[model samples]
Target: MKELNIAVVGATGAVGQEILKVIEERKVPFKSLRMLASSRSAGKEITFMEKTYTVEETTLDAFKGVDVALFAGGPASRAFGRDVQAAGTVVIDNSSTFRLEEDVPLIIPEVNGEAAKNHKGLIASPNCSTTLLVGAINPLHQKAGVKRIIVSTYQAVSGAGAAGLTELEDQSRQILDHKPIHLDVFQHQIAFNLIPHIDVWQEEDYSKEETKVLHETHKILDAPDMAITVTAVRVPVMRSHAESVYVEFENPLSPDEAREILAAAPRVVLQDKPHDNIYPMPITATGSDDIYVGRIRKDLYNDHALNLWACFDQIRKGAATNTVQILELLLEKDWI
Candidate 1:
């Protein structure tokens, strides 16, 4: 494969930083690198591959001569996506802004790699929680035919971006100092409390994050009619995100069979041993690239339903690594 010149938009943000880390850790073959951010962050230096590169203001022209552009920023993609594509750069966006569009492919390479082949210069990464959950569930669903999914998320502050993590840390420090706690990024204090809300509330009372889980899961799995209900909650943890998933399949599957299936799934690690106290935990999963799943058992109330727990580094596998993996696939297929 030929070395490509890559541009990383929103390089100053948490996910963007993780993208750089993954690129370095995996030794992605990039002939050149450019960092782009907002004017406020311009001129800030970010170190990658042992050298410092200053961030420049992101503009349409910034994509010039770039072979691939990774947009980890927010809705700013709307303002610059066309320009990036017009400049002949294939964009892999990590924002929700474009995932649902019919023209753009919402992708998880392991689940639907062929979707990447149809990209019209842009591809989207699914929600962090949705990505991890589907990474584990898709394999099993393919094997046993999933009929329904009931998931409750225990998401980390990092999913809310850097400000979310800072709010949690600062609130904790204030509580430790016996000072008044200030809540900003979230409706309630996230230092020691769990907010049963993520993103905005919709008319049906489900949060945007919950809706993303429902919608993105179907889009990626191509199972639009699949029954899914989600409750997304923000926890005090700084990194990994966890999920309690209850799934009902078309066919009955044993705990051993479930483990055997999940164990062989791509980017999925089965850690289900209750007697040894071995299971997926946020602490153990943080900084790792695979989704860890455990607590496999048949649901007592429903014969075909199974309950499981899953965890993954929200920044890595959920955001950065998934994006990088998509890029790797693009390279392998000569899409870029």
Candidate 2:
């Protein structure tokens, strides 16, 4: 692949840092790198692959001569995604701002990579929760035809960004010392509790995060009519997200058949061995690149339904790694 010029927006944020790590680890060929952040973080120095680069404030002309821009989400993406694209850079955005736009493709390379070819200069990455849920099930959906989905997500605090992690650690220590708990990053005490609400409430009383899972899954898998319901819970874990998924397929799909199909699925690792106590968990998946799946079984009440567990490092595979993979796919196929 030819080396191209690359720019990373939100260079000082959580997902931005991981995107650098992934680019280094994956050896993405980039002739030049532009580090961009908000004005508050601008002028700070970051070192990557033995090279020190200065962070610049994102601007209309910031993406000049750049080949691809990997956005780390938040206000930056909403503010400048189209600007960067208009400047002739391919934008792989991690924000929800452009995801639902009719012309923009919501891509999860493992599930709908080919759809990325239809990009009109910008591509949106799915939410981390949606990424984990779809990563484990899209392969099954392909084999047995998913009719409906019921999912409960146990998301890590890091999903909220660095502030979320600090809140958990500080609050845990505060509770241990018997001090007044501080609530900042989250709505409640996230140290020892589970917040059933993630993002804000949307239509039908579902949190915005839960809504993303439902809608993004349909977009990525190209299953617009698929039935999906989600309950998103923010757990106290520092990293990685776990989900308990129940899928009802149009055709009969046994547990053994599901395992066989998932085991061979791309970017998936099957860890099903409950008798010996081996299954997918947040701790095991924290720094891993692959989504871990286990606890496969047939639903007790429904002959057409199957249950399973899935775990993934939301920061890695869900956000950073997936963004980089999209660029990699285009490079390998010479589509960029």
Candidate 3:
């Protein structure tokens, strides 16, 4: 791969920082790096790969001569995604702004990566929870034709960005010391409690996060009519998101057969050992690139359906790492 000039929009944010780490660890071929954030974060210094680079305010002009720009989930993508692309830079956006657009391909390299080649200078990554869901199920879907999906996500606080993590830590400490807890990042006290709400309410009483899972999965999997329902919940865990998935297939798939398929699936780690009490957990999944799946079993009521648990670092594999992987795909295919 040729070294290309790269730019990162929203560089001061959590996902932005994770993108930097992934870029370094994965050794992305880049000739130059430009850290672009909002005016509030402009002029700040960010050191990556042992070199300090001053952050620049994101602007249309900053994209000149840049080969690829990675947008770290925000209004920045909506504000500058197309203009930057028109300037000849390929954009891999992490926001929902362009995800459902017919022109933009929502990509998970291990899943529907080839769709990225049809990109018209822009591509989108799915929501963190949606990414984990499809990563675990797509392989099985290909083999047995998934007909329905019911998922409940136990998402970590980190999914809410840096504020969520800070709020959880602060509230936990305050509670431990018998002091009143502060509530800001979340709608309710989230230290040791679960909030079954994530994102704004949508049509038919679905939260925005839940709706994203439904719609994005349909698009990415090319199964718009596929039955899917989601219950997205916010948990107190610091990182990673876990999903209890119930999948109904057109053809019957046993737990053992499902494990056999997932065991060989790319970027998916099968940790199914109920007797040993080994399964996917947030603590073990944090900072990891692969999605961990376990607890494979037959659904009690549905003979054609199977149940399983999936977990992955919401910040890494779910957001940052996946964004970079799309870029890597573009580079490997000489599409950029």
Poorest stretch of ten by lDDT in candidate 3: 81-90
Q: Mind sharing the TM-score for model 3?
A: 0.99
Tell me, what's the RMSD of every candidate? Answer: 1.0, 0.8, 0.8
Question: Candidate 1 residues 140-202, lDDT tens each?
Answer: 898889989999999999998999999999999999999999988888999989999898888
lDDT of 2 by residue, 180-200 (tens): 999998999999899999999
Estimated TM-score per prediction? 0.98, 0.99, 0.99
Lowest-sum lDDT 10-residue window in model 2: 327-336
Candidate 1 has what TM-score? 0.98
Estimate every model's Cα lDDT from 0 to 1.
0.91, 0.92, 0.94
Off by over 4 Å in 2: none
Clashes per prediction?
Answer: 0, 0, 0
Residue 141 displacement in candidate 2 (angstroms)? 0.6
Backbone clashes in model 3, listed as residue pairs:
none
In the range 126-227, model 3's lDDT, one tens digit per residue, is 999999999999999999999999999999998888888999999999999999998898999999899999989999999999999999999999999999
